[model samples]
Target chain A: MSKNEETEKSDVKDSTAAFEEALAKTKDKKYVLHLYVAGMGPKSIQAIDNIKRIFDEYLPGKYQLEVIDIYQNPVFAREGQIVAAPTLIKELPPPLRKLIGSMSDTERVLLGMDLISKPNENDEKQQE
Target chain B: MIEEKDRTLKEKSLEKAPTGINGLDDITYGGLPKGRTTLVYGSAGSGKTLMAMEFLVKGAQKYGEPGVFMAFEETAEDLAENFASLGFDLDGMESRDRLLVDHVHIDKSEIEETGEYDLEGLFIRLGLAIDSIGAKRVALDTLEVLFSGFQNEAILRSELRRLFRWLKDRGVTAIVTGERGEASLTRYGLEEYVADCVILLDNRMEEQISTRRLRIIKYRGSKHGTNEYPFLIEEDGISVLPITSLSLEHEVSTERISTGISRLDTMLGGQGYYRGTTVLVSGTAGTGKTSFAAQFCKAACERGERCLYFAFEESPDQITRNMKSIGIKLQPYLDSGLMQIHASRPMAYGLEMHLMGMRKILDTFNPDVIVIDPITNLISAGTEIDVKLMLTRLIDYLKLKNITAICTSLVQRESTEGINAQEISSLMDTWINLRFFESNNERNRGISVVKARGMAHSNQIREYMLTNHGIEIRDVYLGPSGGLLMGSSRDIQEAKETAEIAAQSKNAARRKRELESKLKSLDAQITALNSEFEVQKEELDKLSSEEALRSNALAKDRSEMARIRRADLH
Candidate 1:
């Protein structure tokens, strides 16, 4: 847990430079993410690994991720209103978002994190 | 619920965890099966959330059993604020460690499920909450929300099954709610998973009026009420009415009470209505139904017993003022707190709501007798069948409490016999029917006892007037045609009867005088005959004397001789 906290603190500090340079752009915005899980379950580990791999490939050292084990810190579970394990909350973006389940699908995770915009034409087609 | 716990244990039968909800425990026989998960499903606005919350609240406050409310749709704060109006101190219960409210936020719009994930977080949170308060009751309101949050239906189903088992294994009674579906009790068929008990709530609209009904679809291994019972979402909380046909097991009393009208009492077997029995006073409009009911209440208050008056048409002040004209002093009883007058327009609420409101008042007032003035006005609240059902329940409740009930009903037509009273007359112990007699260009009121159980009551229809002094029940007057007469017609008939009797007596006196005069004339004729006979005898004697004088000289001797010869002095 301490190691995870150190990496989270360092990542925020490291992303501050790009945040200052590209203040108006959405690309270089510092991402603060909270991943709530239930103990050291297999899904929790897989979710952590999957999101880390995505962070390394897309915005390395530009995101801060803190994994919360709701079993150990149940208060956070209530405060966060977490119902499903492996829930990821993106707090830094203008519009907050919450994504649940294993973070294996990189495209959906990116879409959920506001790293990519939704395809509006597909949405309209579905509506039609 | 509290009364049957020891019995259930002694009988080695299914134990129950009482929900403490009004009328719910009674219908469930005891309560929901203990340490089991019961599913409650309903459509939106059908009061599923409120019912589930009440179970927890009541368990915590009344049963000394801490509860955990794990809401899947609403936030804890929202739930607390929502129920605050219902007098449920959710936040207070939480602060006092008697209750724990956990909201599991599920947003389908924000979730993406890529791989396998169990609902272990919800389980852990629930467990932690339970452990914190040692909760004996748990409420997972609308747990079906997990279906929307997760894409794996199979996983959700399996986890739900396992969650119910866990709840049972922990020996904590739990209530799981689901959204109603077109084909099943719930959209996701949650009833299939938590199948120990299932209750369905339905809100139906008929004639632009809405009524909430509850039904126990199944209670595994336990006997329960299977009929759809009308329930009300009252000011305080939900109250289910289990007022079906209860067994005829209520205790009976031989005690009788007065009807306030002495002659009316004479009409009711000369002893009035039996204690703890139902009396119905039915009549046409302006036949004094309200006055009859008020007199009953006055009589109760005079006995120093509490009375509750439910006036569906008139305001309390109006009734008090109107009754004052009839010389019934209701104000003193009201002031002394022996009588409570609750007046409301029947159309203001549904039948179930009115029943529940009356029930609440009944509990608080705990009166010995109750008067429902103009109960026919309640027909505006529901249909005839609904009104009948509502009154049945009310009467059953009153009987159980040994509370004598006098209900007044207004008949639409004088010839039809009060339809409202007729519908419920079978449940009443005594029925007093008042009708308007239209005769002599005037309308008069007549009261009669149509039926009184367990007593020989007068079947005669007596005319009653709402005099300034009070209700005066007059002697029954029979017309020449043997029909009941009233008002000016009765007075006219009585006067004519008296005149005929007087004429008969006068003719008898004239015959007696004529017979006396005939007897006096017959006596005078006999006296005259006697006098004439005496004169004849005197004349004969004078002739004989003259003859005798002519021959006097010789006759002196002859007379003596004749006298001697004529008669021997013997």
Candidate 2:
């Protein structure tokens, strides 16, 4: 387990160093979140994977994610009074938010998590 | 799994969960309504939580049904430790997956309530726990404080309502405890919302002594006792004395046991007290209340049945020492484990406490007969109503158990009255009153049957002496009037009666001799009159013959007519 930790730590160091090189190229906002699930069921795992894939593709090392299983540590959900899981609690970028239900829906999850906004049809028409 | 008969018995389209407390099941006919929440509201220290916890623990252990306990007031560890004295190993049950203790912590300081929230988290956690163990019973201990302390009242009430409905839908027997309200069942007055059954617990102090009482306020579809039953919360958990609500369906016994004294037994309808009946030995001081009670205990022990003697006025040693003088050896019975003497001052505890203590001993010792010496002194602990209620409950319990009980009460020596005229007597099946009869300037013990139900007991008040042979029934001598005679007066009266009877017989003999002489003289006079009648007949015969001869001589001469006439006359 210690070796695994060491390898993961070195991998994080490499990713951070590369991200620093790329961050000098573009400007983006950091994303911080906490995801609560019932247990490591297939749906929960899928939700975790979907969110992680989205984060990796869009935010890269700019985001921090913490996943908690309500089955194992229900205290978080109890303390937060979270109604449902897989719930994504956004605790960054000024306003706290909650995105409940399946996280597999990327567009809805992004919109609900304040990652994206609906485009205005009139503005698009005016642009065209 | 439900049995066929039980399902048919409660065939009200609703399942029932049995709470395995003694006498409790009998009152509920089984237990609380199943698959629904039961509201158990009570004041502080009323054993509401204990009742709920016992329901869960007993359901898990005895009925083979797993349970989940959601304790809101006390933490899981503290609850576990508190219930450990009841011999419930919560940790063990948890390890077995038969129980789950979830402590829902709701500290307002640690909470950040910013937006709309629900106990959806609680529902989720509780649902998951119940599913994990396949639980059948659920207990939410002290839920009132948690909800009232929550920031949002509407959310709390709505969520609690939803929680109860969810539990009902999930098919779990749930118990929800609440703090007693001044004018309502629960502090929130939410009793009208959910729950198929409601029970109320009361812990009150009367005259500086405390008592715990339980009552079943409502059961939706079942028959239940409505009496305020006395309950005790000890190391063994909560025990409700539902026996007070028995329906007189207890079977009676025709068997009669002795009263250690043969004479006393004879006085009790030629046999003794009826088995399973309550007998009251009411008397004044020095009227041998304890002595008579000891005789009964000894008799019970002699039959190899356990007897419990509650001596409120005398210590067990003192009773033993005092009874030994009356030839009642209680030590032997105590040694043989057939007798137990529980002595406590009546002033030491209230009437309810005394009742619970007796009930506690009743359960532990399982005595066949119980003797309570001087129950009158318990009057000091409570009102007359309280004492009467306490004794009625106790007697009801004993009768329901088919346990014969003897109770002694001390009245004023001069008055020799009851606690209430005919109050205790009417409640008892037999009432024997002993009084000190002052005769010839000496006090004598006289016992009489005030009332013995369904039996013909002697109405004569017999003066008895308590010697080393116990109580001896002496033949009562009636005084010149109607009073009972005893002591030297009785001896003197007996001797005088003998002398009077002898003198009266002698006078009767002399009168009989004089009447016989009078009869002899009358018979002699009748015999003399018979002899004179015989002599007169013979003289008449001689006179008639001489006249006939003279008439015949005259007839031969001048006038034979006279002779013929005389001959004709002859």
Candidate 3:
């Protein structure tokens, strides 16, 4: 990765450790997430499935997920400032984060949600 | 499928949506394309966002077409606050369901792109906003911000193309603004997507002065003005000036108005300037150009017509006071609301601002006559071409409205004969040239008509005075040196002419008396000669009688001998 990404990685590493310590002290820390999608498209389905599976494996009943279809509830799109469909917004856990595209990349999702600090091999591919 | 047939059937005639901005519709032949996307790209602070918003606001307010403004840069509250000063009630429009504003905030630092995605959420929000208000017009102010929010260029590009097609399919006229690029029309090449029409706004600085210009780069299925027109952004809105009225086909009126001075009127074809014509009064410094314009303004007001005066060099108080010195009382007309005076320094703003301000005044005042005193001061605001272009459009507009206009120009003393107000002189209908006559060690003012279209005007240069009463045009006076005389020199010439007439009459009377005396002497001498002839005749007659008597006595003696002589005679 470039210099900025490396520095950002080190910063994320420092913050992730502090967040994990707080989570351990609480022992009941919950993640609040809102996924905005358009109707029943394939990307929306894939995103819903991928995020649910990750939450089950890691969060394990310690999270709340609201799947909003902008086609039916278009008002949420404006409120969430969503341009691309299948966008995941972590509204809880202090610092807010927005992840665009389907939740197909688990490492990026975890990094975006502050679950992990280190980036996967995908960072090298992006740099190339 | 039915819409495809409908479009094909009406492809020959493209309908338009009239942008209520001043002077923009005239150059666009009407306005922007209806149910089409127009790409407006410009550099930073070039007024692209303002122009697009004005288009939407004017459409909603004037055309009764509800609009949706999807701002990608400024927030909804900020946009409303910024436009509040321009008299646009955005908050009120939203309440009345006439307009809708949706700000799409996207921060690059907060976004993390992972995998495949499509911009379907934007379409949903935009569709919801439009359907809520039945909006016919939409504005996407700087949509290129989405490029930074999303990392995939291919997805962004395809999504933009789909968005424009979607806007067209919905039959909503849209304006998409983009930041100007170095080698292309937009930073992200947005022009390639929204290709139905494109407009470019530019703000250029020359000689430490800034001017805003707008040009239509392309307009499909329509003809538009190709020149870069100067535009102004005032407290109200943007106004583009369509310079160079394309034709000389404006209608002419036969009505005549007085020039306030009867002698000057007589010199100008025994009437005055035409009712809806432009009169150029050109002269050097202190040659009475302003005074001449004031006289015309007074005349226009005397006929119960409203007159607007634009003074570039003098203040309203100064003009009124100076005019009072020449017996023109403008205070009453001002109080009665028949006259208005707008005075400002020529360098107070750019030439476009001046023109736009004057246009606004013309709208509010609706004066029948306008006077621009000393247009030479405007030269400091811009170049010669700029001034000329501005004046041409101004004169053309005034004529079209049937408003009589008088423009005064100041020329240099040495170059007045050749220059004569430079390029602006040819655009005038009647050109009155005031000059200074330097002779006999004194300077005086003389006035003449250089050219007066459609009238018989005087060719003689008459000396005019700004006396205590008003302007007075004197008769042509020829000096002894065979040139036009003025001032004290004219007075001296008049006196000398009067003395010459008296001397010629006196000499003729003297010769007549001398001839009368000679006739009396000749008559007396003829009488004396006649008396002498009669006396000599009487003496001769008396002598002849005496000789006759003596001859008779001798005949008596000779009678006796005559008898014998008589017999020989028989």
Candidate 3 structure quality by residue, lDDT tens digits, B2-84: 99988888885899999899889989999999999988888889998889989989999899999999998999999999999
lDDT of each: 0.86, 0.79, 0.88
Model 3's CAPRI class?
medium
Which residue pairs overlap in candidate 2's backbone?
B555-B560
lDDT of 2 by residue, B397-477 (tens): 888898988889888645545434337777789888888878679888888888888778888888888999787878879
lDDT of 3 at B307: 99
- Give the docking tier of candidate 1: acceptable
Q: Rank the candidates by TM-score, best first.
A: 3, 1, 2
TM-score of 3: 0.90
Candidate order by decreasing lDDT:
3, 1, 2
Query: Which residue window of length 10 is worst by lDDT in model 2 chain B?
Result: B108-117
- Runs of candidate 1 exceeding 4 Å displacement: A1-35, A39-41, A60-68, A71-76, A89-97, A114-128, B1-13, B416-422, B519-570
Task: Give the TM-score, chain B only, in order for the candidates.
Answer: 0.87, 0.81, 0.93
**DockQ comparisons of all candidates to the true complex:** 0.48, 0.07, 0.65
**For every model shown, what is its TM-score relative to the native structure?**
0.84, 0.72, 0.90
lDDT of 3 at B440: 74
- Tens digit of per-residue lDDT, candidate 1, span B135-196: 99999888667667788888888887888898899889999888888896677676554669
Show model 2 residue runs off by greater than 4 Å: A1-128, B1-12, B300-305, B349-353, B363-368, B378-386, B413-422, B498-570
Query: After best superposition, candidate 2 residue A9: deviation in angstroms?
Result: 47
